[model samples]
Target: RTLLSARAPVTLISTSGDPPLHIAAERPSAAATLATLIDAGAPLAMRDGRRQTALHIAARAGNSVAVATLLGARCDPELRDRWHRTALHWAVVNGQLGAATLLVAAGATVNGVPMPIKKHLKKTSLPLEAPLHSAARLNPASGAQMIELLLRAKADPNLRDQFGQTAMQVAQGAGWSPAQLSLAWEQQYVHGLDYLRAGSNHSR
Candidate 1:
């Protein structure tokens, strides 16, 4: 939690840890740690146990500082996780708007495709939905804002999940109000689809 503290003085920050920052970023928290480490002169592109870099951590954590730190260090934004999801993928899913913005600015692929629903168990499951699907499911202010972020960044609106569900479909399934859906989609052409998939499309 040292690196996560807003009170941590930036200058006294020592990035020392076992395995160095490069190999430590495989885990979400570790990846976040590595971002600061790399910013402090740790290896720039080392992959962790999962072959993921610090950027992946920032993406998962939704920390814009981590994202920019990695990008500034020349970390690959397009680096894929074992499941083939990129940092961009995680940024949208986890709702890291600032990181998401930096990824776009750094030339990350806003149009990156979904990984594929390789598994879905109650114990462990992520359907490899599009970033849009992930965001819509959140139905938060960031969710709507991310739609615009993705659209302006040129993410594909028509991409589908394993169930052939569109982002709009998932958003509707998550129960976003018609007003919410309409406002989001109207801002970008993504909601133009009928969201025809058969699901609740509702959210918390």
Candidate 2:
């Protein structure tokens, strides 16, 4: 309130190069303040030192409230960072289920395509892959729920990664049991039909 009353610049970059909105998105408790800053005309498209939008910070922080607030403000959930990964990519990589859920609900693509692999890439470069690929590479027990969620959301189980491996193949290589893989396939089968039905009805 004091900052707003003082008419301070909400988009001012810190020495670290992050604006107030990016900082706010990193804190779950600061979600309301984030909304306030947005209303005060904080630039939603403002990127940090790493070229990450506030939405990427919020999702990677697992700050679901901040993610929700930003989504409500209609921020670009599809915005990619320096590594060319979307907020959904960060959410799944960090196992931030709530943030991932919110992004998916807000129409973030489940089958996000990976950036082309370049030769002699830096070791710190993040591998941009489909959200399902990230979920598959996670611990099988923990990633099962995320995989189910994405599958239910109509993610393509057959989508290939940069290595040209399908998510199920990735899951198998990541040590998922035959039974677990079977269950995921079944779930995908059922939900995929529902998605097709929904699309067909909408076209009618």
Candidate 3:
């Protein structure tokens, strides 16, 4: 009201070019400002300048409250950002089990392909990366834990990224070691469809 009454310019500031309404909606008391974003017709799945949505950030932040707000506001849990990562994908990559659990229970697809990210790799237009790829980059403990969460949600252990790399293959390449990837491979052997058996390099 004060900013409006003073005719002050409304500004949406985000370090990552995040949408202002989206940012507000992810806050502790975001409920206070949701009506405005709703009325203004904020883009439910629209990415900010950086191709990230508020739901994506909320998941990474492990903010269950904000996640519930977004879901209740009718935000699509399956919505993907530029990287093709839904809220659930980000939650898993950020080592947020609770947030990932909420999104998965809300019906986010377990088999949905996760988006990959490279913080400092040579930049390119490639988008074949996924949250699983990102998770595999973490230390063994966190990376392994993320795999467990995704698998529990029914994420396809046999899922191949844009590069045709399964989670097990990617983790192994990222130095997860054969021992760490064993569980993931076993789960795949159990849940993988016939399609998985047909893929090259799929045999355990």
**Best TM-score goes to which candidate?**
2
> How many clashes does the backbone of model 1 have?
10
Better of 1 and 2 by lDDT: 2
Which run of 10 residues does model 3 get worst, by summed lDDT?
114-123
- Give the candidate number with the greatest lDDT: 2
Task: Report, for all candidates in order, the number of backbone clashes.
Answer: 10, 0, 5
Clashing pairs in 3: 114-130, 115-129, 115-130, 116-129, 116-130
Query: What local lDDT does model 2 show for residue 63?
Result: 95
* Model 3 misplaced regions, further than 4 Å: 1-18, 25-43, 113-130, 184-204
Full candidate order by lDDT, most accurate first: 2, 1, 3
lDDT per residue, candidate 1, 1-204, as tens digits?
Answer: 464355443334225432445334444455556556655566555556566666787677766655666677788888777656789888888777877888888988876654434442332355756677777887556799998888887777778777777787778778887778878877568436454433334321
Per-model TM-score versus the true fold = 0.71, 0.84, 0.67
- Root-mean-square deviation per candidate: 7.6, 7.6, 5.5
Question: Candidate 2 lDDT, tens digit per residue, 63-174?
Answer: 9999988899889988877777789988998898899999999999888855456731452355546889899888877688788888888888767666666677777778
Could you tell me which residue pairs clash in candidate 2? none
Residues 84-114 of candidate 3 have per-residue lDDT tens digits of: 6678877877787778777877888766553
Better candidate by lDDT, 2 or 3: 2
Deviation from native of the Cα of residue 199 in model 2, angstroms:
30
